[model samples]
Each structure stands twice: as structure tokens, then as C-alpha cells.
Target: MMRFAVLGSGSGGNAAVVECGGLRLMIDAGLSAKQLSARLQSVGIDPKSLDGILLTHEHGDHVRGLKVFLKQNPIPVYTTPATARVVRETGIDGGTWKFFEAGQAFTLGGISVETFAIQHDAVDPVGFVLGDQSRRLGFLSDAGFVTRSMTERLRGLAGLFVEANYDEGLLEADTKRPWSIKQRISSRHGHLSNTQVTELIREISHPALGRVVLGHLSSDCNTPDIILNRLRACLGELGHGHVGLHCAGQHEPSDWFDF
Candidate 1:
């Protein structure tokens, strides 16, 4: 069995735990060490029990707690060489760092992980698909737009944790953020919009896709009801109403989902 939980997801911090049998890996370490530990414990997992940490990029929202977490746990950190270099430039050194190139597959214990390049402003950002022998989980967050290669790579997964960063209309109408920031959010190198996410879901839909979790929501411009309703409407039109849907929150961890 494969089980996973999003410790937290949003602009403040983002992290998730993916476990298969005795292997448990963390996807990011955005929260502080203390907060990460508390969240892990809430999910009945000891922080020290993780096999390793896989990074999606060097962005602070994805790696803020990495240095402190490594100081306490000292496990291997897997990421692209470019991201690793930037991470070191940020004064986060030490720990076992293993660099992997995009479009390659690596094995960690009983699980297999495949990395693919993603469109993001950060240095060499990527997405990951992890699986044991029987089940696969696709994770794609912080990407600006979905590509043909990404859709091909993510097809037919048992579970998917994808970004639904913001609603285009809501974001464009919001006056709190500056125009430049809004432009960046909607740019090719920025986060994926709700419509983009819906398009991705439609393109990647498969019979084996059992679960879909909307992640990395904008706390100010997006709401759970809007995202959920939009996704449901899209999937329903495509005859995928049977697929289980969940949303990852910014402040709290989501329930453990088993595949």
C-alpha cells in the first residue's frame, strides 16, 4: 500500500510525505523544523524516520526549512544540480545532497522516482512521479503551465497532487497585489491558474486515476469551493465524476490518502 499526506500547501509553506512500506520520503521542507516535526507527528510519523527529501525547486516556499530540517535529521536531499547550487548560495549547506538530472529515473528503496522539467521562474525547477511496483503518484506544483511532455508523463497515475494556484478572474480583479505581481502570477514562468489546471486534468484523465488533490492554492485569490466546483464541473463533463477529489490546505495537513 502507498500512503501520503500534504503536511501543508500554499504560499506560506509546502510539504508532503509519501510512504510506501518502510520507505517514507518528504517532498519539500518549506515549514520550520519545529513545525515540520509537529506536522509529521500529527500524521503519526516521526520526523527522523524519513528516508530522504526530494525538492521541486529552490524557491523559499518549497525549501525554507531545509537547512534546519537537515541539521536535525541529516538525511539525503535529492534535487537538480542547478537547484542545489542555488540552495548552497542561499547559505544552506551540509547534509547528503544527491543531484539528479531531469528526464531520468532513480530508485530509492522500494520506490521509483522520475523527474521532469517544469516551467517555473526558479532555477531548473522540476516535477516528480513516484511509485512502488503497483501504484504511482504524480506531483506537479509551482509550474507555470502544463506541457505535452508533462501530460504524457503524468498520464494514468493512481493519484495526482497538482497545483490550482489561482482563479484567473479572481486574481485579475484583486487590487491588493500590484499589477506586476499579477502579471508574474499569470506569466509563462509563474504558477498555474485554475483554468490551466482544469485543462491539465482533462488531458491526463485515465481510467486508473483514482484520486486528485488540488494543491498550492492562493489563500487570498482562490477559495476551496470555487476550485472544487470548477474541477468537478470539468471532470464531470468528461465523465470522470467517480474520481475522488480533495484539496490541500495552507494552514493544516490533509488526511492520509492510501492507494
Candidate 2:
């Protein structure tokens, strides 16, 4: 069986630890090494045992503390060529880096992982589909639009983590943010709104879909209740209200789910 947990999930920072078989893997290290260690300890995982860090993009919120964190433990970092160029330019340590295509399948820590392109501002951004021999989990975030490619690649998962970043009504009414900021969030490379998320959920909902986690929310444009109630209402209407829904918190991690 494989287990996963969110160390923290949001634009403030993000990280997830996945344990499968005898391997321990990290999805991203948006937090500092110290913070990452503490978060891992909170879930009873030792930072020293991390085998790798799989990067989704080169955004600061996703790679800020990477250098310091890899300094001591030196886990292999996997990313695309475009992301590696920026990581090098940033003077991040290269000793633990490896390069891979953003839309190919690969192995890390003895488990299989597949990467698929997602719409984002970075040179090459992606969402991940990871699994062991028995089960699969999909992680999709930071994408502005969900392409047909996304729906096809993310099918048939035991666990799913996707962004439900904002409410359309909230985003439209918030004049406090500049026009450009709002436009970007509403753009093709921006985040997904609550409706887009549930819409995508309907497209991907299958019998094998076991757990769903909503993550990478905008602190200004969304609240847990707003997103939750919307999903609950939709799922209840669809007669699948019993599905487990987890809302990621900005200040703390969420509980681990086993599959």
C-alpha cells in the first residue's frame, strides 16, 4: 500500500510526501529544508530518508528552499530541461539534479511516475500522475485551463489532488486586486476556479477514484466552506455525496490517506 499527506498546500508554499513500498518521495519542496524536516516529522517520516524531490515547475513558491533543503540530505531532484536551466541560473546546487521530459513516464524510488503537460506560465509546467504497482494517484495544480489531455491522463486513480483555487464570484468582485492580477488568475495559465474544479471532478469521477484533495487555493479569493459546500451540493445531486473530500489548509498539513 502507498500513503500520502500534504505538508502544506497553497500559494504560500506546498509539499507532499508519498510513501510506497520501501521508498519515500517528495512531490515538491516549496518550504525550507528546516520546515520540510519539521513537516515530515509531524507525519512520522524522517527527512533523512527522502529519496527524491519531483519538481512540477520552477516557480519560487515551488523551488525557493530547494537548495538549502538538498544541501544536507542530497535527494535527487527530477525536472524538465527548461526548469533545470532556470534552477542553474538561480545558482541552486546541481549535485542532486536530474533532467526528464515533462510529459513522459519515469521511475523514482522504485515507484512509477508519469508527467503530463499543464497550462502554466513557466517554460514547461506539468501535473503528475504517480503510482505503485497496485494503485495510482494524480497531482494537478497551477494550471489555468484543463485540457482534454488532462482529463485523459488523470483517469483511474485511487487518490486525486487538484487545485480548486478560487470562486468566480469572489474573483470578479474583488477590485482590491489590480486588473492584471485578476486577469492572470482568470487566464489560461492561471489557477482553476471552484466550478472548474468540480466540473473536472465530474469528468474524472470513476468507481476507482477513492480520495480527493482540493489544494493550492488563493488566500484572498477562496474559503474552505465556499469550495466545500459547492462540491458537496454538486456531488449530492449526482448521488456520490459519500466521497471523501479533504480541504488543504495553509497553516498546517492534512492527515495521511492510505490506499
lDDT of 2 by residue, 1-259 (tens): 8888998888888898888867888888888778888989999988888888888888887887788888877788888989888876898865477788878898866689899999988889988888887899899978899999899998888889888998999999887899999999889998899988989888877766778899998888898899888888877777777668899887787999887
* lDDT agreement with native, every candidate: 0.92, 0.86
TM-score of each: 0.98, 0.96
The number of clashing residue pairs in model 1 is 0
Please give the lDDT score at residue 47 for candidate 1: 92
Best by lDDT: 1
- The regions of model 1 sitting more than 4 angstroms off are none
lDDT of 2 at 67: 85
